[model samples]
Target: MTRTARSRALGSRPARSRTARQHAVGLAALLLLVAAAPASASATPSPASSPARHLEGTLPSGAAYMIDTPDHWNGTVLLFSHGYRPEGSPNPAVNAPDEPTKQLLLKEGYALVGSSYATTGWSVEQAVPDQLAALDAFTKEVGAARRTLAWGQSLGGLITTTIAERYPGRIDGSLSMCGLVHGGVANWNSTLDATFALRTLLAPGAGDADVRLTGFKDAADAAASAKRLGETLGTAQNSADGRARIALAAALHAIPGWNDPRTPRPAPDDYPAQQANQYTAVRGLVAQPGFAWRAEAERRAGGNMSWNTGVDYSAMLARSSQYKEVKALYKSAGLSLRDDLRALARAPRVSAEPRAVRYMADHAAPSGRLDKPQLTIHTTGDALVPVRTESAYRQAVAEAGRSPLLRQAYTENAGHCTFSPGEQLAAVHTIDHRLTSGSWGDTSPSALNSRAQQADPTTEARYTTFRPGPYPRPFRGQGLFG
Candidate 1:
């Protein structure tokens, strides 16, 4: 079972009232540190007298990163961390000290140091140290500020928050965008995803290795299954190596029988066949048969696949090995089919054995109670990192009576980093206000995600008339990003 983009889903806006205004003001006050940045530091030589040079290096663990220094830089510095991908050469496009943030900060007189943490297959324990080391190296090499600000997006956000918590005094403040704060289940929404992948692969539409391999136990039968797979996957959808996809599909099929080798559960109701068709179709189009999947398939065929080898290797050898291997792994991980699927929803948590968890918990505190100012901006219709996540954290902070330091801004239309110029400007304004005034005070409902708001007529009609179809131009009312 797979999900398609829902045609009708409403966006939720922040509660409108004077209190929202007060929250905005509070955020402004918290970030006021940036406003007074110039006054606190001593006068420095001009950047013209000195040109900032970019430096690159690798950590002891082989994680690579880079740092840059502006001429005659003041003490202020910012450390940049990217999400997911391994850090290598700096990509100035998205990296800070790149175009946008760099130009703004430089004009305002702040030194910037960008870094790439240890890349994929490496956890934050390795990454954070590499980042800190980069900062130290930048300071000594370029002669900049003793303290620095940490910033990241998505996975980068998680690392940024963890770094902020772990090195409180050493870090000035953290700027996290769409970061994952809640660990375990919240971080890994994959169990259901795995189930869906299995279902799609096994469905009657096309090549299904699981079914091909199931009946045959002998080597001849295994060879037959592989031959059948080669024939079925020759189509564009299943073509290329797609080893991970194959592994995921195989895991889904094998997991069910491992727990109840005899009994089988029915498919889920939510993933209607039409939705599944749409998902497979769209995904097939978007992730064409060449790059990531093809390479994965080639790697698997070569007996050298990375990124969750457990799932891949097991699937590749499913016909040869007994079911015991997968069963043992799942049982150890508490993912037996005998349990309710919802119970399996709790992902690999901190309590899960250390060997199984990916990233190390740098600072595992119950959410910290911060006295400093903080502003959180999120799109109500975020498809990638749902806005509900931010709301949960805000609610937790409120329940703990530590809401004083928090300011929240909700945009109706944006999703993840997707935002219209108007929405982006608003976000920039919010950040600017926080940095300048040390407080924020704006909390009026604004049309951001038009599609999302249109899902609810009452909300949509209140703002403006709703016309549905491909997004109409110069989009106005209830939507920000097209």
Candidate 2:
């Protein structure tokens, strides 16, 4: 999905106690690092005069990493993991989200590091290990970090969370921004639901030209099929039935209808406007070739990893938070929800290859067993990674009995990872405070907004209270795709 669509699709804080021994260890480590550096090197410099130590190297696994440590070492290393890059796209070599944030962090004396995974295109398996390897490289090439924080955006957010859970002792804290924390099964199935609805509702008999849920031969073919479906949906949007169907599809996945941050969210009774926004999101889904990632994911997994077999549209909708909106839209259009449900029931269902499903679970799903402090940030208006991901993750963490270990924040923007330098700094500082104090500080939206404003006046103005709807069809491991 485009950043706009991702922002539109989806949409916390506290304090605690600290252990003296742990605090002493962390402090001692920091002091040791500072003492080891040349005394003169500890002096901060102006942005124009700052000299950062830069290092770049390739890991044995073929992943490349870059590390930047400012002249004034802060003893904290921000190990950034980047988001997904389509298989054929160029990979980024740096870890920072934006130049402004990068400079701000460096100017504040924080070290930054990141890795371009061994392979691209949803390679979460490679990313997790590659990122760890990059950190190892950092320790050898530079020096031991007094504290390390795993941070990432989008797919990288998943990687960051995984690292925290899998290797808690390796890092002190983690920050995940706009991550797909709901796991690959939930993410792909959500997309599948939307695409299947579009095909069943509008282009049912298009045959070979229709978008393929699986079995794509290549990226070009996947893109072409997505384009075809998008074009069909575009024309279909002119009618009430088409628009209602689009809303139904989006709701099944709990996709939000606020893609543009500049515009206010549609009011509860504004069915027409809501559907219009949903159509744009749906259009962006297929038009931007959002579904193309499914093909790439399947290719990497060696087969299909998603399915709709045994899925009951009625049951699914009943569980969806978007059900009310779907019902309202259908009623306004004088459409029969039962009839649409029947149509969905009659459509041929897709099934997943068992191995592929396992591959996704192993690489893309979080265990939700938080062993260290972790914080997540998402824009309430992000359509690409959807706020539903945060909701699903919260459920998982609660289920694991580790709710207190995790906290979440939201930006009032409408684009994917559309955080300003101030917002980014606020989140980083929040994590840093938690690590040092061993308890969360004030993490309320108002508190965070205040901090962000103080850090940068240009910060986006929408950091108000909001909660994301439930993620429709959260992954439950083994039997999820059956």
Top model number, TM-score: 2
Residue 356 in candidate 2 has what lDDT? 87
Model 2 gets an lDDT of 0.81
Compared with the true structure, what per-residue lDDT tens digits does model 2 show for residues 1-482? 00111112332324434786688789999989987987674463333233457778888888888888787878888999998888778875677988899988888889888888988788898898889988898777668787999999999999898898888988999999999899887888778888888888888765545677666788788888888887888888988888889988887766677767667788867777877877777777776435677888988888888888888888878877667888887887899989988999999888888898889888888888999889999987777777878988999999999999999988876767888888888889898989899899799988887777777777553466777766657575587677
Q: Which ten residues in a row are the worst by lDDT in model 2?
A: 1-10
lDDT of 1 at 466: 23
TM-score of 1: 0.48
Candidate 1 residue-wise lDDT, 234-329, digit = tens? 342342223233333333322211121122322333222212232232233223221222222222223211122113222333331223333443
* Residue 454 alpha-carbon offset, candidate 1, angstroms: 29
Candidate that would win on lDDT: 2
RMSD of 2: 11.7
Alpha carbon lDDT of residue 171, candidate 2?
A: 95
**How many clashes would you count in candidate 2?**
16
Off by over 4 Å in 2: 1-51, 205-209, 262-265, 288-290, 319-321
- In model 1, state the lDDT of residue 276: 26
